[model samples]
Target: MKKLIKYGNENSQYGELYLHDTNCIGTVCLFHGGFWTMPHDLHQFDNVAHELLNLGFCVWNIEYRRIGETNHKWRDVFDDATKAINELNNIKNIYNHVNINNVFVVGHSAGGHLAIWLNSQDLKIDVKKFIGLSPILDLEIAYYKNAGDGSVEKLLHGNPNEFPERYLFGSPIKLKRKNSSELIIHGNMDDYVPIKWSKLYHEKIRKFTDISHLIELEACGHMDFIDSKSNVFDVLKSNIR
Candidate 1:
């Protein structure tokens, strides 16, 4: 069982913190998936939270409002993640035995996209490392595919033409930050997000910053990166240290 604590708006689709302490050295904050989404299903959070706990990492898995999650935007979700991490950092004593410096942020699918988006932001409080497991980092690609009839476009509030700059910001492949927050992980070979997003993001950012690294995985698909029993766990574990 996980201890639940509510922060931010209890009634609003925003500002609720699902705090889980694994009593470990690293403190990881995980966001859920569904196209940079929220009001998300909590099922995927369990295994990774539990695995990180058993591995001795204090995990503060977060829950925030997503696209269909109340009145939120991609930028707002990014801010929400930032504030949540700062909130946790402020009250680290409550988390217990958690290393403050080893703090990390991770996401799967859309959540993975959010993790990278937030990490790539020009914020004052920097996340130590980011693990975007098969994140939809390139909104433009999804928009072009019109897959799910432009489901990715709809999440960004419709039509990349309506929000050209927003697409640029959300896209790790497009934006070139002089320095990036640490990113390391692999995308599932079968996943639709494609390795190109992570790949291009690495290629461009690596020119200016050495903090980012992306690994492409074989025989793995999308959510498999977070599953402890999956082969990705070995790859993720290998580099996390």
Candidate 2:
């Protein structure tokens, strides 16, 4: 069973905590993707969370502020991401059964962008690994390619030339790489987020750390990687190390 914990008063500022009964491996902070919009929520990763629980890992399926919400801004979404991770200790203290160790951050699509971005932050948490599923790695490329149906423009509120600071700070590719091992899984047939972005990100980041890997799933699309029923899930399990 999962428990709901609120980090902020807003409707979007909470996470579902799933705890395993035995052999608690560690904590997995899971974030979903909807191009940083409200059309999608944390429910998208319920299956993945359950799988993680079965793997003996506690899951924190986080829901952060989205662009479509009232008075929402990209900055709020970023702030909420940090807030959610910072709240992990509180959750452990409140629920005596909750034990968090060897943290792993995982996100899909735009959430993948958030995962890597959060890793770059000097947070108190010690994340063992970072994983991106069909993630939007490069914001500049995303802006140029006009990925996510102009969602990137809508996210930063303008073009790279208009708001260069936002791109420089918000984009994972632009941030300095962390020492933790990172895994990127993208589908070859993905139309929503180009696989080339993943490849480019991998090529650049691999120079800094040899532990990073990019796995391209054949005949899979953007959504297939998150679907537990898909064969891509098996690949995800094998490569999570």
Candidate 3:
């Protein structure tokens, strides 16, 4: 069963923890992607949470403030993610059956970008592995390409040339860490956030550490990564370990 929990003051910034009756392996921190805007929220990850629970994982599906919301900033989204992770780590006292050391992260689309960026941050809890499903790893490229109808600019508050430091701080490509074990999965036919981003990210990270890998799924699209019935589901199931 899944239990609703609040990680932050706002109702939008909360998490759903999927707990098993027994034999829980670890936790999977889920972040949903909708170009970092308000149109999409954590509800999209309900199926993902259930699936992860069935796979013996305690899923912490999180929701955060988006750009469309009142007075919400791009940095707040990142801060919300950090707070969620820290809150989950503290939950061991309440839910002692779950393993904390095996905590992993699975983020799709824009959520994937957040997952990668969050992994780069110096958090109290160390993520065991980060799985990004079609992440927008390069903010600079996303800004130039104008992905999601200028979603990059909307999130960063300006274009790359206008806010180079913001782009530098938010881009996962620029924030790649040497100690992280990152697996990026992209669909070959993804029109949004194209597979090339993951390819370039893997290429860049592999130079510093051999722990990063990029997998391209045949006949998959942008949403296939989150579809429980898709073949990519098998890939996600296997990689959660």
Model-by-model lDDT, in order?
Answer: 0.66, 0.85, 0.86
User: 38-108 in candidate 2: lDDT tens per residue?
Assistant: 77999999998889788777889999988788887768888988899889888878765665667888899
**Runs off by more than 4 Å, candidate 3:** none
Pick by lDDT: which candidate is best? 3
Per-residue lDDT of candidate 1, residues 15-78 (tens digit): 2233444445666778777665443554577787777777667676777656665555656666
Candidate 3 weakest lDDT stretch, 10 residues: 172-181
Q: How close is candidate 3 to the true structure, as a TM-score?
A: 0.96
Give the clash count for each candidate: 2, 0, 0
C-alpha root-mean-square deviation, each candidate: 3.0, 1.5, 1.1
Clashes of 1: 2
Q: Write the per-residue lDDT of candidate 3 for residues 1-241, one digit (tens) a residue.
A: 7788888788687888888877588899999999998889998888878888888888899898887898877688888988988887677778887677898988999899988888788888878898899999999999899899998999978887888999999988897584868899999999998898889889898888888888889999999877887789899888878
lDDT of 2: 0.85
Model 2 TM-score is 0.94
